[model samples]
Target: MKTILITGATSGIGKATAVAMAKHGHRLIICGRRTAVLDTLKEQLSSITEVFSLTFDVSCLQEVEAAINSLPEHWRTIDVLINNAGNAHGLEPLSEGNTADWDAMMDGNVKGLLYVSKMIIPGMKERTSGHIVNISSVAARQTYAFGVVYCASKKAVDAISEGMRLELTEFGIKVTNIQPGAVETDFSMVRFKGDEERARSVYAGYEALKAEDVAHAISYCVHAPAHVMISDLTIYPSAQSEPRTIYRKQ
Candidate 1:
């Protein structure tokens, strides 16, 4: 059983991955900004495997550093780090995009992943064993009219994942980037800035991917043999062909 640390464990893909890994008998270090939700998840998954939840805003470098640095000696040896804490703040044309939304995307999606990885990588190097799973998006592969910033952020993730794999090769640390298309999660709600109707409309008339589907993909990557590594993977729904093309029966 591996010791896995998952960020954004309070909901969606992160939460599903945490539960799936727990069932596989792996110890979980769940990190999120919401303490109550994290505690609740810990209670739910603790029956299957050991769970340790840390509350910190990943966008804050100081918080990321302090939280990981303060982990008890045992928990510090994280065998897997899942960078899953990211969201789309708003969907808008680049000319009309909100500055705050742009900052949130860059800070949380790009900088936050870097900060958390920076804190966790040294131990992996020392041990010469670890896996890093970065949850990017289909947006990274193609650009859409109103998804400029979100696409840019995920593109950065893709690049960083590749860079990390190259730099960590000598140390035997594996980096995997998972790009997912149109999963039915709080993502649309957040992207539409809490407009529930708008969010629902995005997933209507189609069978979108579920959080569990992505979780299962992550589990597959994690369970691979030590000598084998799944470098990069992209999962899309049957109804969706790419980031901008989806067939809706309605």
Candidate 2:
């Protein structure tokens, strides 16, 4: 069975992807910050597939290294790494934004991705065979006024995917960037800092993509033949072409 590692696997897209991958019979290493939640997922998926869960703050680089070092000896050579641990915070214009929010966004969305990828790459490089999927946002492609920092972070992810692809291709490491638009998840809840009413409003009037949609897409990308790389994919809700261009019901 193929082995896959997923960060941010406690909720939303990452959680959905974990469930989907487990159902497909892939051995999985699930990582997230919440130990309780990760343990619950581990319990739930254990009957379905071979799985291990790790709890660590991906934003903290050292924690990532420690967690990897602590992995079971038998599960170290992972076949795939899904860099999905990220968050968006504070929907406000740059001039009025809080520095803490900016830092959180930068740390989680960009630096967290790098830290996790760095920990996994050496193994993939030695074997010269691995698949890496970085979860990005439509924000990576188009900037929104109030989403400047979040958008910039995802844009960095976009660039990282491309750069890694170029650098690792000869080594037979495959990298794919998945840029999804308006996914209905706790993303807005995190962005709005627990404002459930506001988070719900973002998707109230339109049919938006769900976490499972991205999960299915992720499954498809990874399940492809060894020689074929999906490379990049952009998915959007039918009701929105851009973040600020959503057509909501009147």
Candidate 3:
């Protein structure tokens, strides 16, 4: 069983992926900002397999470095690193966008990912074996009105994934970029700034992808045969065709 480290493990896809990996009988290192939540999750997963949880804000480079460095020697050789901690704050037209929202998105989605990866990648390079799963979004593929900044952040993720694959392939490292569309999670709630009605309406009319669906996809990528690399995967719900085109019932 592989030793997998997943960030943003307190909720949504990250939390789901942690459970999925545990079921695969793999060792797990879960990271998130919420200490109590992380402890609770660690307790839950301990029943299944070996589990370690790190509490740190990925956006803080120092925190990211310190947390990963604090891992036990055995857990440091992470076979899989899932960069799943990211956010989409305040959907609004570019001209009307909140600068604070823009900063939060860029810092958390782009730099935070880089920070965590920077800490863990060296060991993988030395071992010449690893898989990195980056959780991008369908927004990376298509630009929707009022969500330009958020889309841009994910676009950076796509680019970063490609770059890592190109550079790390020779070391036998696999980098997979997962772009999931309209997953029913706290995403819309966060994006809508805690407006329950707005967040609820985002998924009201049709079947949206569940967090587990994306976790399942992640599991598929990491569990592939030794010679197989599921490089890029984009998942959409049956009722949705793309980022901007979703069929809503009357």
Candidate 4:
């Protein structure tokens, strides 16, 4: 069976992707900061596929490296890596944004991705085969008020994905970037710093993209033939015209 490694597997896109992959008979090595969540997920999936869980904060470089190194021999040779651990800290204008929020976004979204990829890419290189799926956002392409840092982080992800594609093409490591518009998840709640009401207001107008929607896109990328690599996939709800535009009915 194919082996898949997914970061941020506790919730949102990552969790959805893990479930989708398990349905396809892929052995999963999942990483999350919460051991409880990872353990629970392991239990839930134990009957369907072989699952290995690692608990570590992706934002910490030391933690990421150590956790990956500590993986059992059975989970080391990863055929696919989903770098999906990321966050949007606050929805305040950049001029008055919280430094803490900015740091959270930077560390979790950009550095975290790098740390995990660094540990796993070597194996893919040695095997001369692999696929890296990066979960970017529409914010990566379009900036909005209070979204500067989060946008920048994902922008960095977009750039990194391109750089990986260019550099790893020779190694036959396919890099896929999936940039989803809006999803009804804790993403907004995190951005609003636990202000559920504020977060809910952002999605009042229309049916935003769901976590499963992005998961389907990721599943497609993983199932594609080795020779076929989807460089980037940008998906938006039909009522959504852009990253900042949404049409909500009354």
Off by over 4 Å in 1: none
What lDDT score is found at residue 107 in candidate 3? 97
**TM values, all candidates:** 0.99, 0.98, 0.99, 0.98
Give the poorly placed runs of model 4, Cα more than 4 Å off.
none
- Model 3 steric clash pairs: none
lDDT of 4 by residue, 1-250 (tens): 7899999999999999999999999999988988999999999998999999999999999998899999888779999999999998867787888898889889998999899999989999999999999999999989887788989999999999999999898999999999999898899887777888899998897888889999999999989987799999999988888998888899
Clashes of each: 0, 0, 0, 1
Residue-wise C-alpha lDDT for candidate 1, range 1-250, written one tens digit per residue: 8999999999999999999999999999999999999999999999889999999999999999889988999888999999999989887788899999999999999999999999989999999999999999999999888989999999999999999999997899999999999999999988887899999998989999999999999999989988888988999999999899999986
lDDT, candidate 4, equals 0.91
Residue 48's lDDT within candidate 3 is 93
Q: Model 3, 99-152: lDDT tens per residue?
A: 999999999999999999999889899999999999999999998999999999
Q: Which lDDT values do the candidates have, in the order given?
A: 0.94, 0.94, 0.95, 0.91
Model 1 poorest ten-residue lDDT run: 87-96
Candidate 1 versus truth, CA RMSD in Å, comes to 0.7
Give a tens-digit lDDT track for model 2, residues 139-201.
Answer: 888887888989999999999999999999999999999999999999989988899999999
True-structure RMSD for candidate 4? 0.9
**Model 2 pairs whose backbones collide:** none
